[model samples]
Target: MSDDVTQDAVLIFAKRLGEIIATCEVSAVWIDSREPCAWQYIRRDGETIIVTCKTLQYWAVRDAAARNGYRLDVKPDEMDVMPGQQITRGIPHADKLSTLAVTPYLSGNSETIFRSAWGDGSEYPTLRRMLRYASTADDLGRAGVIGKTAQEMYGGPLNSSSKVQRARDTGAKEWRALSASLDTARDELIYRSTRPQKDD
Candidate 1:
């Protein structure tokens, strides 16, 4: 799933996610449930941006920067690359979002990407798979991490509840431990994407 397939799946996923969030927000209004949300939380460095979000939210931003493209490096599981930073160098595009909940470099690295579900880059199972594909058995041993997959960590993929709980825990812990590092983010706002609807 590394080539066009992975890319296409991710594109469809982000596009669909944007739509779902918008729809859920809209539906909320029908019952007077809650006000619509138009922003996301993000952290970044010079040419890198890290978003600690549910899985959907992370893919919402990436390197490609086309309206729906993200060229991710998918770094090694043991590179100490920090959990969530794929080094995306720009802001996101969202028709709905007015602002992004921005902090500074919370993880030791300036660019980190995190998923509320997996707690760290342990969310990146692909990195491990790629290693298995490219490396000799000895190389894997040298690499040290077989693959700290989210499934391995939590017994299975996360659900909405798990994601919420992890995000709360990670956000609090990181904020407490790394508060001093939260420097002035560049003045910017980001993302709420919507694919154009077809004229049925």
Candidate 2:
């Protein structure tokens, strides 16, 4: 989707979310039948700021800073950017969160964006998805080469729990072998880089 469309969706989503929260009130007194629920609001930075009735936390600090439109640094798939960051007061305005930076793709260069969006997952799959909208075939190919090289260097299938378990049981010998393979792959990519290759 276009950036405009995605942004519009986010705006609509934010408004709807705000409306939903406006109707809900938390009271621990009714915990016997209805447990006190924690409400989380997704700020423009894609950070979910949660309000816990037990602590009577209203996200005053984060909300106050965000109300003035501060740039938020958030991790991917995280509820809060700075977890355990405390808020001592109540936020006066809620709509200000709509202006915070949310989309990861909107900031940084291609490489930086790619790396940030990938998180700790398999780099190849992430690269493949990012390459879908690449401006040129060469760009996609280069990313593929990078992905393949990274995958091989990582000993492949890091996400496969079973494989990792098997590798772990092989102990010190396997670690040495895998480490050697990775070093070789790193050297190969580095050697190619020093020769001055096309960016694409």
Candidate 3:
């Protein structure tokens, strides 16, 4: 009911959440405080992350080095987008003829991100630059995207011939680099599976 009590509750919840996420593979997790409009962002990859203010939760865990802290009262730095996820201007809904159209009129950064994979705005170059972005079918499935793997998205790896696939491929160099990069990502970062995996 009181502000202190509410803060204490959030602190407790954050402590528990950190402990739970530590043992698994996670792209990002966060806590938002509506009162002050503060957010605590946690991410394992190279993406910029902020877990501000070292709340009671951080002190509870007593591991300052393990978490990156920011002051919620100040302006937080820009954060790279979460892996296996993309921002959309809107919902970018699949229209009535969405599935039937080959080069359907896809708009918005949300739709275009998937549509322009191989060109100047393509994702392969983006993925190559990231060096830490990765996901498995499991992760994509969890993200609720339509296709799970590059194969499912395009047809097969190293073969970016499909319309949706071409939107992401860019050129031979970017394509090859992305393929190898994803292979390494899938190999080194698999959370639960025993064999190598691939993802879109």
Candidate 4:
């Protein structure tokens, strides 16, 4: 096979291997770039199975069976991994993993922003700081900031526009204040939902 084809095949196999391992609650995962294999120790039936990413599906199946002390014939052609009912492939694979590992209680542009902010290596003091940044232009530059920060850092997607509006409509400014004041600005966003307004 050509080098490009080989690489593509390897990538596909690696992702499928990830789905399988994650389903088993492996607890830890690491890819071996040197060997071009993804290996993990997954828990199955109250036991551990060390599975390897090899093109020889039979070998991987046999090894997993041996490790788990199970007797099942995992056919080479039929050994495929599916995650959460989605047959993820290519970009979808990475996207699925992103949802698994990264997505928090956020949606839309805010979720985008939060992840981008973290990628830049700034460690905010608390969840409050993270959410306060969301409404700012600075935070808007990042992708999924609101979604991730609220979902992962805070309890849920408090920074989301829809939730913010709900709080506002109910005159529950305290909720937004409680969330936003936790961080850098230390003040509720004036334009935020549920806050009383005066004509400019």
Q: Number of the top candidate by lDDT?
A: 2
lDDT tens digits, residue span 1-200, model 4: 22443445455556667676556444223333333233334343443444434323544443344444433444323323433221212211122232322212122234344444444323333434445656564547665554544444435554676644443333334434433434322122212323667699
Writing each residue's lDDT as its tens digit, candidate 2 over 1-200 gives 22443454455555544654685443222234564344545556776444443222233334334444432343323433346542223334443322222211122233444344444434334334333434344665444433333334356643355544443344344445445655565445445535776798
The model with the greatest TM-score is: 1
TM-score of candidate 2 to 2 decimals: 0.17
Candidate 1 accuracy as lDDT: 0.38
Residue-by-residue lDDT tens digits, candidate 3, 1-200: 22443455467667655664554333222323222211233344434332223333443332221233322234323342355332212122222222212111111122333333334435554343322224433364354222223344455553344632443543455667655655454333332333566686
- How would the candidate models be sorted by lDDT, starting from the highest? 2, 4, 1, 3
- State the C-alpha lDDT per candidate: 0.38, 0.41, 0.37, 0.40
Candidate order by TM-score, decreasing, is: 1, 2, 4, 3
Q: Considering TM-score, which of the candidate structures 1 and 4 is the better prediction for this target?
A: 1
Model 3 regions lying over 4 Å from their true place: 25-200
Query: Which TM-score value belongs to model 4?
Result: 0.17
User: Candidate 4: where are CA atoms >4 Å away?
Assistant: 1-15, 21-38, 59-200
Model 4, residue 93: C-alpha shift (Å): 28
Lowest lDDT block of 10, candidate 2: 99-108
lDDT, candidate 1, 50-111, per-residue tens: 22223344454442233434344443345334564333333344322222222321222234
